[model samples]
Target: LLGIARFKALSSLRKKKEDWIDDDDAAQVPDSADTPEVVTMKEDKAAALRRFVDALPEEHRTVIDLAYYHGQSVTEIGEVLGIPVATVKTRMFYARKKLGEALKAAGYDRGWP
Candidate 1:
């Protein structure tokens, strides 16, 4: 029963996330009222990054989504995907490197924290 309930909750959250993706107006904005210039620049960068991530190979994209979107740890992603933890780590590493290179090619100069 508990497992079923958890699944239902996760399903609902997934649906909401999908809806947010489909609706650009649903994106969260800063409360401090960012200037139009800053907002446009940020949006452009975000769109570029998203395109890069979407272009990743399936395995790398899966790891990236599970880690960042679903907020799963390396071990958790491995368990969910039925892969070894080392594989998860490797996918993440490669995904990040690919994304970094793509972003650089897109002229994104901001350093990662």
Candidate 2:
């Protein structure tokens, strides 16, 4: 029932898109339409990042989230968490290395969006 309603919602959304975009931008979409440069990376990059976060150790996740997702400085995160700056730095390092390793293992190092 939820899925059906969601599908209907999406069906309505597709119709609504016609109103949101002008004919010029509508034609620009690839097959459907092309995305704007503001989007930067494609959906693959977002999926890869999600996978990286899921595979990371829990303890390091906070540091990674703070530094990568929130744009917080390592020192700022340390201050917020009441941990030493070095510990925060170490966590950030390990988190990045682990995410890199995970992404590499998934065969996404070079071809990721």
Candidate 3:
């Protein structure tokens, strides 16, 4: 009985996460009130990432979508994608580098991390 109950709870949690993804897909961008660069840096990143999604490779794009849009942790993303956590982090690293290049080429003066 306890095993079945645990299974049911896990199933419900997975469904909830799926529902959240659907909602995220429907979410539209909101205009942020401009402030200083430091303040914007902390909160503006998700928006920035969304804007650059099309430029990402499918693997990096899916990982980021799971993490940000689906509100998943790195470990969760790893589990979902059947990859190790280290690999997920590597993809994120390369993804950031790619985005940095694109942004710089577009004339945005985003400073180094």
Error of 3 at 73 (Å): 0.9
**lDDT values for all models:** 0.86, 0.80, 0.77
Better structure of 1 and 3 per lDDT: 1
Question: For candidate 1, lDDT tens digit of each residue in 46-81?
Answer: 888778889999999999999998899999999999
Query: What is the lDDT, from 0 to 100, of the residue 59 in candidate 2?
Result: 71
Model number with the top TM-score: 1
Segments of candidate 2 deviating more than 4 angstroms? 1-41, 110-112
Off by over 4 Å in 1: 1-33
Evaluate residue 3 in candidate 2 and report its C-alpha lDDT on the 0 to 100 scale: 100
Better of 2 and 3 by TM-score: 2
Candidate 3 local lDDT, 1-113, one digit each (tens): 99999999999988884324455665665656555785676456645656787669999888877876799999999999999999999988888788778777755556631
Q: On a 0 to 1 TM-score scale, where does candidate 1 land against the true structure? A: 0.66
lDDT of 1 at 32: 79
| TM-scores for all predictions | 0.66, 0.59, 0.52
List model 2 lDDT by residue over 5-27, tens digit each.
99999999888744478899988
Predicted model with the maximum lDDT:
1
